[model samples]
Target chain A: MKRRQFIRTAGATVAGIAAAPYILPSGSLFAATGNRRVGHVVFCMFAGGVRNIETVHMNDGNLLPNLITGAGGISPDILGGMTALPAAAAQSLQTFGTVFKEFRYAQGPTGHFNGHTTAITGQYTQVDLNLRERPEKPTVFELYRKHNNPATSALNAWWVSNGLGPYPSLNYSNYPGYGIGFGANMIAANSLVNADAYSVIGNTKNFTDPQLAKAAALRDFLDQQFKTLTPDSARLNTASDETRLKLFINSLYTKAFSGQFNDPLQTGPGVMNGDLYNIAFAEEVITEFKPELLVVNLQGVDVCHSNFTEYCDNIRKSDYAVRHLWDKIQATPGMANDTVLIVAPEHGRNYDPNTLIDSYGRRAFDHTGDASSREIFCLIAGPSSVVKQNQLISTNMGESIDIVPTIAWLLGFDSAIPSGLLPGSPLTAAFN
Target chain B: MYIHKLNIVIITLVIILGMLVSACKKKETTYYYEVPDAAVTGSSVIKPNQKSTLEYVSILYADLMGQSIPQPELTRMVTAYEAFGDDRIIEDLIIRNLLNRQDADIPTTPEMRANPTQFVDAMYQRFLVRKPNDYERMYWVQQIQQDTSLHPDILYYAVLTSAEYRHY
Candidate 1:
């Protein structure tokens, strides 16, 4: 059967078995024998204006002295001033060292749509909605799913959000799996609710056939509700809005068809109000599904539009979350030696010598200015077997175009698939 | 009458002698004169005082023409003229004139031309008193052989340094 039809039938089977307990013995048998080589990639994307000088290149005496270490050394001097990590957690960060050793920023326009698209695709498309117009060029995630074959598993690829919009759904070909629509804050809330829901249904941890069926039914209901609420007119507003809505719809549709939302709600700490909530959701997803490839786009550092003073604080929070995700990945069972973690900002903020406020009050400036606005960081940390360990690789001429190719390379696929469109060199040094 | 006749004969003889002597004086002695090497070769045709002007022109040609000019011909033409020893100054002045006359209509050669080298050699020989060295001679001949422009200005420096205008 085709992948989509198989997913649909599997979902129906899980649901049908749930209503009747006759298939419980067979479900248990299948769960015991299922063996898959799972790989997970966590992307800590600081969507909006995170300045290089403040977060990554903090050498001068700035606000967060502890987080802003001078050149050459790894540890920050003033550990107490950083608000992101707790005292003990901050101490551990000093040992983790700089993750941005091989990272480099790109020069381009500073529009949100342009920067985000460049960050993912490695090519700057003038039209934001051009992906839909031209679907031949595949996204890194889409390519990964195609290579891995998502038909045999319960979970394939998960896009858990922290701050950014729902993952770009235009890149999704007819993939059988769902992309969870819950934003970082929303996902944490849903996980908490789902955890409670799972408990009340008397299915804790072990996802039975019956539980899968019920989750699929709920997913189908939610998909119908979302489609009813979001009319064709509402869905087709702008390119970005349409892209986001499609992702929401696709996630609901995939979940309903796959019966993979068996453990929908699993809640954690009340850190959902700030950047910590994003970290919590990422940690929750990593622990729950153990998905082969997971992309978590953290967006709170873009809080520059709201208040300029808290920009540094927001970046610190993002850094704290990055450290948290790395810690979890290392601690996880299968992810330790196989997984790769990447961190980078979607775009940088403007540079201000005096009060840290640009014209847009969010470091908004020309796209291809100096190092201040154009410069960003990219950090990759994983097992020595999968990625080079404890080495500072040169990134002199690297651009945003390299990200997609680098991801494809790490996944052991020829990234030259989008040859003409991307035209970016893979970060070869990052991997062994 | 005898006395008068005798006086007349003496006077006539004296007059005749004076006229013969004057005639002899008037017939200037033909001296076997040797031509100076400077005059023959036109090397020293330009006096030391006039060396600067030629030198200036040579400099102007070199700079304006760039490395594409045959170096041997330039060196030979500049060295042959006394005024061109200080080629830089003379060259500057010539360049200034050329710049001023840039918009003026340049005369065109109607006939099919020889190579640049052959033209340069022919022009050099036509203007100079003595022929240049085999290398210098061949240099302009080759240039003219390549590009046909019978106009002397095409080989202006070579023509200027030649022996043809030395007397003038």
Candidate 2:
């Protein structure tokens, strides 16, 4: 009788474990990453404003062959045309997870800054959203940093952008209780570490670890005295962490000046742009830190405002970059088979073209907050055991603002964040 | 008449002798003591406003070169420093770069090692624009005495990246 009862209990527990997601709400199923399926995430903003027509809709030819499938044939005017020479992924990205084909950025001005802010903060900001100011809402970085167990380091979360501009400020926010202490490590990959940057900091003296430690211990003593007046910004990295970061940067300076700093992922000249460069840096960050959360922003497609042909080519380039990043992520030790990569545009471009015509005679497009500009697509690919495989959500089930909470929920830190901070719910339908 | 005059002169001379005798006595003097400035600085209260990026680079350049940096160099410095999230590491790198330059107005390591007291005092005045108080001076001197690898370049790097230096 004891054995029969034990078997019955075991069977009941298995059934309950399998059925808990349906019984409970999406976010309610798990409150922490240990119990959740996936913890690592890579949120890539296919930025600079892309339209669905060229991407998910494929009204032209299929520009993102590695990411989006079913729509075949390459666009004739696409720069250098499409080639399968380099396999983007083991398979189409949609095969690995779900694709939200008809997502929307429901609110806020359809500008790059506003879109990025909304996506990162999970709130709909207005026209007052300045390009240079920190987001009024707490960023996902803050939410992750402040709530994650074992008190994660700044290295565990990275924000890689094509350019600094307003991107540097997005790592943390001006929101009270969640500031620089909970910010991500930010790198403007395209501009921060070029040959010019190497020229500025190339020949810094290299101190040994023991020497640096002695200096750092002394610095710590000084910091203890100045802690009261040193702003939060000044203490973003701990004395030891700052020392480590300095050493890492010194290494980068050496590598950059030595001419070994170029990204190997940029296979061809046509694919060489800021987007891939930024992704290459993201790959480096992932390799180095194996961060739990890393957000990458690509802006090459913003060239669409002036040249439509270049815009199409840039979309393909971004696709290639994101594909290479995933490939790199899977190749990484701690992140392999564990990291979930989410790709979505901050917002979409307008449907109609303006007067500017490119050399290809194609008219240029602008994202002027039109109805079509509100539409976007979010593709989430992860392990088959974790993410819904080959699932397609075409009923406009999600919005752009949902990305923050969605990320938090996947990382299992959503419950720790105050509900009021994230106005959007996790797109649970895309997960198992 | 002659006798009366001689008697008056004698009396006057005696009185004058008495006055001289009274004027020949000794006198005393007084002295007071003073205290030196405290060991730690008053930097905590003085620098209230944060320096703008422009001010920071310009001042950093001037402090390193003993002359104001060119506007173009200053602009590049500001741009390079502002192009990241954490200014601490970047500023630390910039400090090292500036100090590594041949034109940097800093004492040599051997010169500093020869006289740690003067090195600490000069550093306090040079980078922090104040005197290293008694404890600061003593602690730094002892540090330089103990740690053979602690060079003036590293000390300059430390002070340049310190919170007190970032202000004002």
Top-scoring candidate (lDDT): 2
- Local accuracy of candidate 1 as per-residue lDDT tens digits, A275-341: 5555655566577656566666666656565454455555655665666677788888978766777
For residues B119-157, could you state the per-residue lDDT of candidate 1 as single tens digits? 444444444434555545454455445444324333443
Docking class of 1: incorrect
The superposed Cα distance between candidate 1 and the true structure at residue A59, in angstroms, equals 3.8
Measured against the true two-chain complex, the DockQ scores of the candidates, in the order shown, are: 0.00, 0.24
lDDT of each: 0.46, 0.80
Candidate 2 C-alpha lDDT tens digits along A263-309: 45847544467787788878878877899999999999898899888
Q: Which stretches of candidate 2 lie over 4 Å from their true place?
A: A1-34, A77-90, A127-129, A213-234, A261-263, B1-46, B113-118, B138-150
The collision pairs in model 2 are: B39-B133, B39-B134
Compare the candidates by DockQ and give the number of the best one: 2
